[model samples]
Target: MEVAVRVLPEGLEPIASIFEDLGTGGVLIEDPTLIARYKDEPGDTQVVSALISGQGDLPVVKGYLPVDERLPERLDNLKLLLDNLFLEQRPEISTSELPETNWATAWQAYYKPVAVGEKLVVKPSWEDYCSEDGRVVIELDPGMAFGSGTHATTTLCMQLLERHLKGGEVVIDVGTGSGILAAAAAKLGASKVMAVDNDPVAVRVARENMVLNNIQEVVKVFEGNLLQVVTGLADLIVANIIADVIINLTKDVPRVLVPGGKFIASGIIKDREKDVQRALKETGFTVLEVKREGEWAAIVSILGE
Candidate 1:
């Protein structure tokens, strides 16, 4: 069933709590800037209410449950919980028509080969991309998941990988969106590579890309958030997610690193670099280098002694 939630400005915190509590399919952030600025208490409680979409003449019911209950019951409680929260008033929503096609095929029209440093090139699977002068080619399809190596963050991360990754090292890619970084690690001769993402779709897509690259066995893909489900120490850990998630990850990334393990992070705006660096410092990582392209930045850090 499709469910749409309208959260007033003040209700955003509760909405975020609901997403975290219910493990919902996917969240479409209407106001990402506002959500990014929200501050949360350590033990904040949340309530979730599920209401049927496009159901006419049916009275909606809302229900409340503690965070530990099964997801189905939490979803069942949506209508009741929403009724109390909104007092039975439906929020106004606008819909519009746009040109549509199979996005996978449509995306191919705009996809082009991108050069990431002197040694590496990223090409779409539908295109025939040949590297001149013996450069490394990473063939990928930018499906519904993000990270196709065209973003400034991905390019910066790849440049860092080109420089720092030594053969036979263990590497971990946190938030491995399309398994791009993990595949690059395999190509660079990393002895072991593990890629993890919270989205199962992302994990599936990453696995498919790994197979396309003929490195499916070399790069293992796992479905989970951050580094929680990942085991073993890594010589290199690369995370290309938002600034806030990167900061949260820094608190635990060092623990999964060998003594001299290196950490590479991107997907941060230039303005947020200092804050992310501070968070990394608190987690025993010393910033070794910073690379900038346009409005984005990537940081390389080594575990502190």
Candidate 2:
């Protein structure tokens, strides 16, 4: 069964939990207003318009379930939970049946070689690409992890990384999702790179990606929260996490950075740019440049000696 639920922003977590409890493979929350940004063809405008009908900015959360004998009971349970959660303005959910699919790998069909920077190309492990321009490639198999180097958050960090990295500098990637940034650092000429993440799944996928890129010798993956497991001086540190986290991260960044070392912070929404800037400055950093793509921003700064 396929289901799509329209709910307010605050309701996403609860509704997603209900869907997961019903044995949904994955939950996809989407804002139709933002869908236009990812569409490339002229005909896609109509599709975007169709999605925007009457939805406004309300997110549409989608999930899928297998057809089984217990499906009716699961559906009842989901509806019951939804009603108990929202009494005043209950959200509407739609459902339909879908043919059996190997959806886990099917999403990879949309994954293609993307040029994130001037010389950097993010390619999937299952895809083939010939680099006629001698561009650097970071082969990846993200699996359950998030970083595929295509999202604006990841791309912005990659662009800034390309601009600042000099040959043979030690690099650290905090909140390293799928190990994409660590691989990028190695490809961009960083001598030794440390990729850290608290999630074991991310650590495993990132390690697999490093091996896929043949960068294992240079990039080491570690499971840890933020920068807690990181020590010593780093020439550059890149974090592609949220604004509040980045703001909190400012406290420890300066101490870990070498004098004149650079820090690239992304995963910041446009509204939180000023807050991140203020925090970085208060931590004794001089903001060098801020780059914005779509609704996201990446800030590059250096700590005072």
Q: What overall lDDT goes with each candidate model?
A: 0.77, 0.89
Encode model 2's per-residue lDDT on 1-305: one tens digit a residue: 88888887778888888888888866988876577564665666776767667556678788887778888888788888898995456888899987555655778999999998798999999998999898998898988898988899999989998999988999999999899999999999999999999999999999999999888999999999899999898999999999999999899987789988999999999999999999999999999999999999999999893
Q: For each candidate, what TM-score against the reference?
A: 0.68, 0.73
Clashes of each: 9, 0
Model 1 poorest ten-residue lDDT run: 44-53
Each prediction's Cα RMSD? Answer: 11.6, 8.0
Which residue pairs in candidate 2 have backbone atoms (N, alpha carbon, C) closer than 3 angstroms, thus clashing?
none
C-alpha displacement of 88 in model 2, angstroms? 20
Q: Which residue segments of model 1 deviate by more than 4 Å?
A: 1-101
- Candidate 2 TM-score over all chains jointly: 0.73
